[model samples]
Every structure is written in structure tokens, then in C-alpha cells.
Target: MTGAVRLEPVDERNLEPLLSVAAAEAEPEDVMPPVDAPAGWSLARRDAFREFHRASFGGLAGPTRTAMYAVVSGGEVVGMVRMTRCDEPGVVETGMWLGRSARGRGLGAAALRELLHAAAAAGMHTVVADTTPDNAGALSVLRRCGAELREENGKIRARMCLDSAIPIR
Candidate 1:
């Protein structure tokens, strides 16, 4: 049960859809900043999404850059993934979120794997990710991707080498 996974660059044409998905999937305990809509969605949530989208898209600029992409599966915008900024030069840290309708379908792992492929193709030597200990879904994805795990500052950190396979934790 696999769907075609593709990466679409975040641009003006796809920006609204991305924001809508973010608003729909907002979770209170999400590791990343939430871009949720307000209860009535008249003011606060709209403003928050605007700021988040602006900052996020702005980060796409320049030579030393971070890449953010919309993860599309079966032609629907399911989520977003990115290589976040890291102090290490050759390592890219990744994170993603699936919309409510897209959860529990194994899409998260698919998206992460695609991100890993992209990172490796871009000359990244290693990839890293982190999630809370209790996030079984995320932990499962990391484990399935064969990421090496360690606990740091009370969070579970996962690292993988693009040049070789790792023992899943």
C-alpha cells in the first residue's frame, strides 16, 4: 500500500495549502511551533500562521540555507518536512507533521525517508531527529529508518549515517 511520494518546493502557489494543513494538524504538545487556527479563526490563529509562514519561507533564502518542502502523497499535500539549521556543517536535522487525515497511514516514515534521500543527495553525511520518549509513532518511524538513539536533555535524539546502515534502537 504505497503512494507516490514527491517533494514540492514551498512557494506562493502552495503556501495557503501548507498553512491550512498546519492549522488543521496543530497539537498543543508539538515539538515545533504550532500554526493552528483560533477557535473561531478570526484573528489570532491567522496572525500566527502569517508570521510562521513568513519566517519559514524567509529561511529559504541565501547560499548557506535550510530547505523546507511540502510532502505530497497521491497528489494531496499531506505534510511538511525540512532540514533545520544545525551547528554541525555536514548534519541535517529533520522534522515533519502529518495532517489529521493523513495520520496512521505510514506516511510519516515515508516522508522522513524521502527527506533522508534528499539530504543525502544534497551531500549531507548524517541526519538527526528528536522526539519525546512517549511519542511511540515518531519513535517507531525513527527506529524503522534505523536511526541510532540517545537521550539528551530528557529528549530522545536519533542519528543516522547516509553512507551506511544503522542498528535501529
Candidate 2:
């Protein structure tokens, strides 16, 4: 079982652990390309990712935004999730990953449930996610997280309509 998870605003404190997970979870077929993979999350890649995070955070932010968060459980950041605005005015897209040590538990679902609620409370009515076809784990996470799924242009698109009264998990 996984412990209770907390969502913390990404900052200098939790950035390293989050990036470390991002590196460890990297795969060649990943949509985000796992940053500096093979070589692992190298220093340069880490810096660039951080810079991108800062820029994305600073750009057109609202209560609902590409809000970067560290998924904390048992006093550590086991994963990270980001919610960004989509072309649809009230829709947001989410992306997330867990470290190897954090996989196979119910943590991802619980944490994502929280993330969905956060986005809903922030005025986002829907959340979307896309995953590679071969990413079974991600597909499962989408189903378990209460997102509606579809295949489009070779990727699985997960869409979840959020309501303040909706109960996830």
C-alpha cells in the first residue's frame, strides 16, 4: 500500500528528487523523451528542464495552469505531475511519472485523484492526458484515475470531465 500523498508546489526544495524520478522513468518511446535519457538526467538536462519549468510556470499562469507539483509520500517526492492549459478554454492537460521505487503501488492513482480535484477546484472542467500505445502502465493509470480513453493519431488520449462534487478514488 502507498501512504497518503501530498501535493506541493514545485520549488528549489523538491526539484532534484522530482527530476531524479523523471530521469529514472525515462524510456526512448516516451512522449516527453525522458529528458536526458540513457545518460540519465545529466546536469545539463536537469538545468534545462528546471529552466523550462520556471518559464512554463511563469507564463500565463492561473489557479489552473501547467502547475508543476511534487508528489510527496512518506516524506519524499516519489513522483511529479504537471497540469497545463489546453486549447479548450476550460480544459487542462496533465502529465506525470513515478520513480521505479514508486511503481506497482496504488500511489499513482491516489495522487492523480488529488491532482484532478485540484484542477477542478481551480476552474478546470476537464483534464486530458496522452500516452504511448505501449505504455500499459500509463493506460492503466488513466483507467484507474477515472479518465475516458480514446486512440487518436497513434496515441491514447485520456479525458476526464471534472466536477467539484466528483469523488475520485
lDDT of each: 0.73, 0.74
- Lowest lDDT block of 10, candidate 1: 26-35
Which pairs of residues collide in model 1?
A: none
For model 2, residues 1-169, the per-residue Cα lDDT tens digits are: 4647888878778777777666677542331434553454557666766665665554227543568778888888888777888888989888887777777787777778888888877888998998889988888778887778999999999988886344455
Estimate the TM-score for candidate 2: 0.83
- The candidate that wins on lDDT is 2
Candidate 1 residue 29 C-alpha distance from true site, Å = 6.1
TM-score of each: 0.81, 0.83
Scored by TM-score, the top model is 2
Per-residue lDDT of 58-153 in model 1, one digit per residue for the tens? 442434366778889888787777886577877888887778787777777777777788787787889999889998888988887888999999
Question: What are the root-mean-square deviations of the candidates from the true structure over C-alphas?
Answer: 3.5, 3.2
